[model samples]
Target: MTGYRCEEFFGEGRRDAASVMAYETFVLENTDILDYLIKSDLIGETMKELLFVYKTLMKEGMLIHTGFDTDYEEMLYRYRNNEKDRVEFFEEVLDDIRKATGVNVRFCLWLCDSPQECLDSHNADQAKHLKEFEFDMYDTSDIVLADLGKKGKLCGYEKLPEASCSVQMENNL
Candidate 1:
């Protein structure tokens, strides 16, 4: 809502003057549109822009793909063959997504090492439990369990009644 300053979100010394100016101009030109997206909750404050765009395209049925092979890949190949750079091709793609979903996507990408192991763990259930323990509380009394924590024990076992000690008491020396 405030003035468009790229350095506010990004760092001051990250981008050159020319790149910053261009980004600022773009933001200023699309102020109203950005405001609309923000107000509509289409663009969240902390949400990653790439994720938002992907979700929006999937929601709007714009990205028609089979996960293995995609039409978007063919589009990108054609654009690359036509001497179109990545920036231009992606700008067009973003514009198309914006026109379809009314969300203007912008994000700063960073390079990082591959975290395939972590990603695999997140994607699949990699639990390594040799034996799974399951407890059954069927027909259990509710009142007996009320003091379980304080007593530090469950109510399943109780002390048996002591045998009569009359014979032992009579034989006392």
Candidate 2:
């Protein structure tokens, strides 16, 4: 391939200092846009993880749980002990980014508070109605949505359309 294939790295460790400073400034300047890209998954899973680590280690000055695969086992790992996995991944890549450029991107959920909820709604039966909403920044937890009334026991939440949700979340970013 003619490409350098640099996109394959876990932590490319090549974030230009100017780019870092620029990105930090951009994040500070356009916080909403950056968060939108994250919720929409515009940067892809790997870059999403990189940004997640960057956000935790640098910006917020605290770790967050991310980099989760939707597989049942991985979900279990994240669901049961997300802190450990997220933290370990952050720790593993923190120094490299520190030595190189810095962190990237924040978070936003156009249709719901968390990524899992978005996934849940995205995967739900097409018959359900979906809506777009955001949670208070202070509210970062997921709520179990059990079936009730005449619905089945595994009733799911309504979610925004997948491509539309991605676009909305990435509107300005």
Candidate 3:
């Protein structure tokens, strides 16, 4: 199994919401020096890494937000009653992501082996850790089972907290 490549939203404050936001604000404040640093060779290694991680997490968070909700049970309920088909759902997600992040990300809806597996991963128990921190949770209509990236090389997936094992078993039964 590919075991789904999952991106942990935060890491010991490295990618936490507050850190990301603060660093972003700092970057915006320092825009005058940003182009100079980039054009010149004065950019330090630490700054380079921070910028890379920030951009990566921001994009990943946006992708996850498009396909998930804060509350697991409510997310599942919406999934059960969703009226749009897969194409419609994914397309809507793609559009929203573009609008939110201003990045043109392409998604592959059938990259995963099964939709249920994707749901299980997205709502896995590990995601519950999110409740321990502070971040805005998206109200999603379905579990997004797609890989996010470029046109031919899509490669990102994520799982949030609070997945219900009983719900999985109940559905299986």
Candidate 4:
């Protein structure tokens, strides 16, 4: 009734279906990002710039493939084929997503040697971005560091309580 069973019920083994579900969920959950961009009148410009950066990173093989969605695959393919107009591609996708869904979900991206490093990277990134957006920083670093230090490594779904859907690391790896 939970854990792997829940994952199985979601058809996790079927790449296409899982991907569609993930994308749909992402679109629905992050409507605020779209709304913010629209309100700031930076949606088109941001998308173009982001797409360029994404394509360049992909070309340099910096973007890791996590086997989650088709959009990533398409981006990879375009990068490999050298047919991607980075600016145009990113703008189109961002614009379409924004127009379709108005939410903007927070995303944490990090590159670190260890879990703590990852957390630090995430915090730093969040701080910088939030500041740029003129948003208040909650300073959750100490809490996160304490929790991760106590846990040792990131907690998997199985280790969490039955009623809890949130993801947490169990160890500080």
Off by over 4 Å in 2: 1-21, 24-33, 62-173
Q: Write the per-residue lDDT of candidate 4 for residues 109-166, one digit (tens) a residue.
A: 1112243344443333433323221111111211010012321211111111232232
Candidate 2 local distance difference test against the native: 0.30
Query: lDDT for each of the candidates?
Result: 0.28, 0.30, 0.31, 0.31
What does candidate 1's lDDT look like per residue over 83-130, in tens digits?
A: 334345435434544454564444321111122222222322332331
Model 2, residue 14: C-alpha shift (Å): 23
Cα RMSD (angstroms) for every candidate in the order listed: 26.8, 19.3, 18.3, 18.2
lDDT of 3 by residue, 10-50 (tens): 22213222222233223332222223222333234554444
Clashing pairs in 3: 123-163, 127-160, 127-161, 128-161, 128-162
The lowest-lDDT stretch of 10 consecutive residues in candidate 3 is: 148-157
- Per-residue accuracy of model 2 over 1-173 as CA lDDT, tens digit each: 00011111101232232232223322333233234324542235554564444433444433334653334334334423444454344333333333333332122112233333443444334413434322221221121111121211111112311222222121111
| Model 4 bad stretches (over 4 Å) | 1-84, 103-173
lDDT of 1 at 150: 19
TM-score winner:
2
The window of 10 residues in a row where model 2 has the poorest summed lDDT is 1-10
Q: Residue 143 error for model 1, in Å?
A: 51
